[model samples]
Target: MAAPGTLRRFLATAWLITRKDITVEWRSREIIYTTVFFAASCILVFAFGFVKDGRPIDDVASAILWIAIAFSGTLALGRTFERERYNETLQALMLAPADRPAIYAGKLAGILLLMLAVEAVLVPLVALLFQAPLFRQPVLLVALLGSGTLGYAAVGTLFAAMLVRARSRDVLLPVLLYPITIPVIIAGVRGTAAAMAPDGGEMARAWVSMLVFFDVVFLTLSLWTFEAVMTE
Candidate 1:
């Protein structure tokens, strides 16, 4: 595709990039399969390692859900950008006439969608394995997961892009991302736990609101700095 020539084409450019990533992944299915397996394995390990009387300890299910998300998300982010780096297409991508921030937005949107799809499977599995009532408040639960995952992905996409050319990015990605995303992780856990409770609507909504705000802040920062950050 040719480089975009006008600021008016920002969204179009972003969507084009997103479509490219999605099409590539659709052809290979490598990232999604590995991410799902890794996330499922994390849940299973937590289930077995932290069981009490053949059941996971109280509130452990929520924690496990977020932990699996964070871990597997980092894996997905690393590999997503790694493909560009490996193919030596990142420079070519950056050199395109499209807005750099639009590129970041495209990557963020694609990664966010992928994470949500993984969560759709992970959530049901966690409910079954841990006997948690994750779907009792389906609306609130989805809101929390969606907002929280957006916040997590907003930060992750930026860092993964920034570190794409680094030698130690695999090790460094989590090192940099986990600490920064602690608030997002905490909010996700709290909101999910609340949504699973019988009378926790108010609390769940509160956490979801906070997560939305965090998403806004993180995304704004990421988009604003993406151009300068990606500079050689």
Candidate 2:
């Protein structure tokens, strides 16, 4: 067990790092606005292209929703550490006198917060534009969002560290991330679709379980591997 002081220090460090991320975002607001705009544009394009046949927009709403989210999320995750790389602050953070996991946890928390905020905006916009029944089942929607976003963040955090050093970092993140995140996306979409249905209890439960399992597995893997990835 950690000593009281150790735990306190860890919490303080995590809080400080989280605050730094929020402060940076508050100053620019570029990432959030860009992500929201891209997401909305993607949904609008889908609405125009796919709804021409007079089909109910909800018919393909799930696919469109996830595609927008996945793409926007990739954009945000790629940029998460870009400022640090440009400014050389990541090395400073690594050299700080704190446990590595605290850094990782802080970053994870920040990314998760950003992701949830993006989704909060995107979900309603997509639903409104596509006429999908998004709020019909708030509980399942919450579960799907929670599990899927965590899984995306888990892999994304590590890749953000890795790609920060690469030449094609922006392009590389999605190429690396998409293959790994398919399972989570699949589970999320299925769970969300079922949750939107009146008789979707069992399906929703199963997909949520799969999502939870995926979250636990990838989260552990990301935490364990983050130190090595960051160092390399």
The prediction achieving the highest TM-score against the true structure is 1
TM-score for all models, in order of appearance: 0.95, 0.93
Roughly what TM-score does model 2 have, to 2 decimal places?
0.93
lDDT of each: 0.92, 0.85
Once superposed on the true structure, which residue ranges of model 1 sit more than 4 Å away at CA? Answer: 1-8
The numbered model that scores best in lDDT is 1
Estimate, for each residue in 1-232, the C-alpha lDDT of model 2 and write its tens digit: 8799998987888788888999999899988998888988998888888776655555477777888888988878777788789888988999998887788778878888888998898888778777788788898888888888899888888888777889998878888999999999888888888887888878988998999999999988887887788786
Clashing pairs in 1: none
List candidate 2 segments past 4 Å from native: 1-8
Clashes of 1: 0
lDDT of 1 at 199: 91
Clashes of each: 0, 0
Report per-prediction Cα RMSD to one decimal: 3.1, 1.7
